[model samples]
Target: MGAAFITPGEIIENSSNLTPGKGTIEHEGKIIAMVQGNVIIDSKSNTVSVKNDDEMPTPKVGDYLIGVVDRLGEKAATIKIIQIEGDGRSILPEHQYADIYVAGIVDRFLPAPVDAMRRRDLVRVKVTETNPVLKVNTRDDENCGVLSALCPQCGEDLYAKPEGDKNVHCPQCDYSGYRVLSNGFGQGYNLEKNGAAAYNRLKQRWSKEFDEIFKAGIPARSVLLRADHRFDGRKITRPNFEGSGGNNQRKERPKGTKLFVGGLARSIDTEKLKEIFSKHGDVIDAIVMTDKETGNSRGFGFVTYSGKASAEVAIKELHKFDLNGRKITVNNADDKSSSKREKKPSGKKIFVGGLDWNVNEKQLEKLFSKYCKVIEVSIPLNRDTGKSRGFGFVTASEDSADKAIKALDGFELNGRKIGVRESENKSKQKNNKNQRSTRELQARREEGIED
Candidate 1:
């Protein structure tokens, strides 16, 4: 063979025949291949070597690189190298990832990578090392740092703002923030100015605004931390922060009395909700659920009254009542029954249908408990919204099942008559094609009306 294929640790030739070179190593009395490649025999030097079939070009010291901010830490940032400047060859897979420390971002003191560059920012850096690990730097470089970035708030393209307190400004939103800017920022690859020199001309030290907003020692002054009035369409409403009682200890309320308030407008918050429900009786607590990422209302909440009678009054009066252009629903919060707890198949079960969206499992149990000894109650809920599916199952004593069904069937609760009957095999309904829950059907009907 002109050149033989070899694998790592495979014997290539005797040590006396061919001296070890490159991918080959001398072992005992043999020249062994150290890597998987094609074996090469150097005739002039009389040495054996291996050549990789798929070798890739790597970045060298002093070479500039283009990358995106992949991950961040308190002291450093991980950059995923996208392109090597002035080079057409691709980088090796193992050498594509690089790290840029806080010190390498700029000469000034940076608390973390977030202050200098955010995730998904396009940055330019100079390679400082290629072995052991890829290391890059942006310090004192006019062409380095962020080339392009989007506004963190409104997702609009940010423009260079040298005159503002922050280095970048969003045209579509009121977001102004700092970044380790490059000479080519907002200009793509065509750079005409020295960014580092311009940055040096501005205030070199940290400003008071920066200290209050991001510094650890001072209280957070970011707009995100404050409860401000948010505008929706033409309406304006402010979100409620839980009262400050020194510590965050919640007040004690009777168990199994929490109420679910649904179909609320996005503008409604705890304060407004409490104000509307407080007329019935003393409201212990009220909470409006909000999105974790965006900090916006999810249009539903929970309320706790001082007594069950007050809870019933709130539900009866507020369910299907209009507030802020929406028909809100109020009912008992779902909870496991505190009555006789028995395993499955221990009692007679009944199917309850035509339930109001406000009705919860606890309410169903309470209704059945009046006629018979309740064993357990189950009401399926929407996984995404945690709202009632408007139906439930109740298990009761054998003798009381028929009596309870007879008395409770067609009973008016929350302005709607509910159907209660012996439990049937629901597996067929589950297998039925194109079947949707009551809420889904209602949503689809509403969508059709809009169209």
Candidate 2:
């Protein structure tokens, strides 16, 4: 008779082969105890019971019970009995429902509780003192009631029809439910999430049985199934950056709130950028792009804000403004390079230096068009003198640029040695060969930061 006492949801046995009896319930392919009690394994019957000293509700002959209509089977309807009147025992959300046989149902001669008892409708019944498991009868009780319920489709409160067909119907929507409603059916009470009063009522007024299960800290996986769906503690999974903040904990902006700052001067550091941008809004974070190996500014970085409004304001005020001698462009992190990518910058742009001053765009295109697809050829000329500007640019495919670099570089063409190399956007690059010593400016520079 003596057994090991355990708390609610404690694993009584790892095996689900045995049947859960009395205060025990089967969950997640395992039989777990539902109360602080003894784990009773009956080998002969192949059954388990959570026996405990706590005064759990026991079925007594002719005792009135309060229960919710769980569901109806062909032979019987299951009732989630919550309270046993006069015995002072209540049904908990964690406590599983018990089966109510058809014979025990009121109006035994009738086929079923048609237009009478609906699923989720609360009811009152009398205990019949049944065998292996307890059974209750709702055949006769004027005090019994259908506490509260909602429309299956629209989530509006189901109003009871006391005069007509006597079924519950949604006043706002075309939905109905068969229920034996007492005086407390639809007088402005509901269990829908949107019902402010009802939600608070459910939260504040659950019975002691539900309170016990609530404080038990039931695992999340099985929490939704329980009667009380309240969680007052942190989840088992920890926050990622719990204690990473230094002496003073710094607030962090949300992931997408970061704005990418491109075309920045290499001399601008995180603090300097933060100081300038904080004037527009509250900057949560400011990180100047730096080389991983050498730890130097790579001509750009990111600034973050706690709110979307702050980031938008920062972008509008600070974009294209001079910062540490370089005009910085500030855009949202996602929109930063995404719009830039649409302008065709993946391939190389070839630069043609040391031109013969006589070569035109057509003549240059005629030369490199033999190597690869020449996108465009531009030979600048003076309007007053009408002569070549000494140097021109030949834009071609990346593979073609490589070919032109190897073939035409330092090669005599039209009696002049022409120099050909990858085109460089020398606008943003401050050439910090003197300022930064810690890290090399190689982050986006190699990928054409100027682009």
Each model's lDDT comes to 0.76, 0.62
Q: State the weakest 10-residue window (summed lDDT) of model 1.
A: 218-227
Q: Model 1: what TM-score? A: 0.41
- Candidate 1 lDDT over 146-209, as tens digits, reads 9998776656788887654488887976777788888888777767575532552333777787
How do the residues 1-451 of candidate 2 rate in per-residue lDDT, one tens digit apiece? 4576688878776554788887778888788777677778788888988877775766667776667787665457778877776555555453335667655554323234422455666666667755656676655443344556655445566765532322567787565544544443444223333221221121124345333433443232122223212233222221233333321234654454888888766667888888988888878778776664466667777888878898899988987675543456787886645645325434668888888877777788888887767887766555334466788877787676788778888978789999898887554346743543223456547667642
List pairs with backbone clashes in candidate 1: none
Residue 66: error of model 2 in Å?
2.8
Give the residue spans of candidate 2 off by over 4 A. Answer: 1-5, 8-34, 37-53, 85-95, 101-109, 176-178, 183-451
